[model samples]
Target: MPSKSSSHSWHVFTATQDPHHHHHHHDQLSYELPYTMEICMTELDPVLAGKFFRRSGDEKSGHSAGKEMTELTGINEINKEAFICDFAFDPCGYSMNGMDGELYSTIHVTPEDGYSYASFECAGLVNNDDDDDIVHVLRKVVQIFRPGTMSVSITTCSEYNNEVWRKVAGAVEPLGMKCRSCAVDQFPAIGSVVFQTFTPLRWKNASK
Candidate 1:
């Protein structure tokens, strides 16, 4: 078992509207970006996972629990303009959805023995300068779950390039994880996809 590990995957797809349709009505302006990220993790620390559990006898709704977790996890701090909707599962789990202007982000946690898992996903418009934002978000997520292993998938139009994966690797490696492998491929007309895997340094040493 790797002490810390991660992977990233990317995809690209066509846009339904003209690329120059930014002048459309605000409501018609979907926040859908040219890319998407699906990051997954496992082997979460029990102490950190426990934070997802609702207090005993507390009958708050899932939305309420989500709000509390979001605040506690500093998800609210990521983008103050984003409207958040969240839910808390019984015993130990949490999920949240956030929309900031046109961007969307979501998080889910399943902290159970034998099947511990968590995921973070988001979509937004990005320019060359947005790499720092990815780093910040990725780091915050790792802090939340402290997973021993993780995988990240990024889907984006071919025109967008693949620099984001390097930033992703930079964000998590300092936390004691190391990148083990990276694979890239094109999805026909969809675009390009990149998959990167990471493992904890401790695990690497043990395997040797």
Candidate 2:
């Protein structure tokens, strides 16, 4: 079962140290600035999934305050969902909301099959001048994915430069992981990197 606190949660994408220090508390501008992604995944918990799908497709959900929230779509139907992208171009800032800490637009994906992945452009914060901070963020992501699994792969770096990625892979190779691999592309100007994974479904036997 999904924990009570983890379900139907809210997040604030702030560029300021104090997110609550609103530019205008009573106006729509308060929410317009923050890039928000409402997370709706099917298998965060099966019990929740059953309850959610039980209602009529047009029925209002308690979590939505009478607004109808529909069924999952595309990759969202899987047990794991896609990483939410944040394209805000700004410096990092401290966050004080739920699971609060220093937050970044960077998104990391972790599958229950013991594999973790990270995808960011070389021009992003992951490859910024601060090497220590970059490693620390990656470590935090690893902890989120598999608490004890040290092996990870840098699956996507949008700045299609192998030499730069090689340097990054080498830097984190010693971080208590069995292996560190780089998944890259050759001519990114004409092509992009795409990653895919599968989810397993189980069935029971029937007797005649």
Tell me, by TM-score, which candidate is best: 1
User: Residue 196 error for model 1, in Å?
Assistant: 1.2
Clash count of each predicted structure: 22, 0
Give the TM-score of each candidate.
0.79, 0.28
lDDT of 1 by residue, 1-208 (tens): 1212223443444554444433222243333335677778888878887778788988888788778878876778766778888888876689888998778998888988667889889875654545656677778878888888777767666645467668778989998877776666655444666667666789889989
What residue runs in model 2 are displaced by over 4 Å at the alpha carbon? 1-123, 126-129, 147-160, 167-171, 187-208
What are the Cα lDDT values of the candidates?
Answer: 0.72, 0.26
Global local distance difference test of model 2: 0.26
Error of 1 at 173 (Å): 0.7
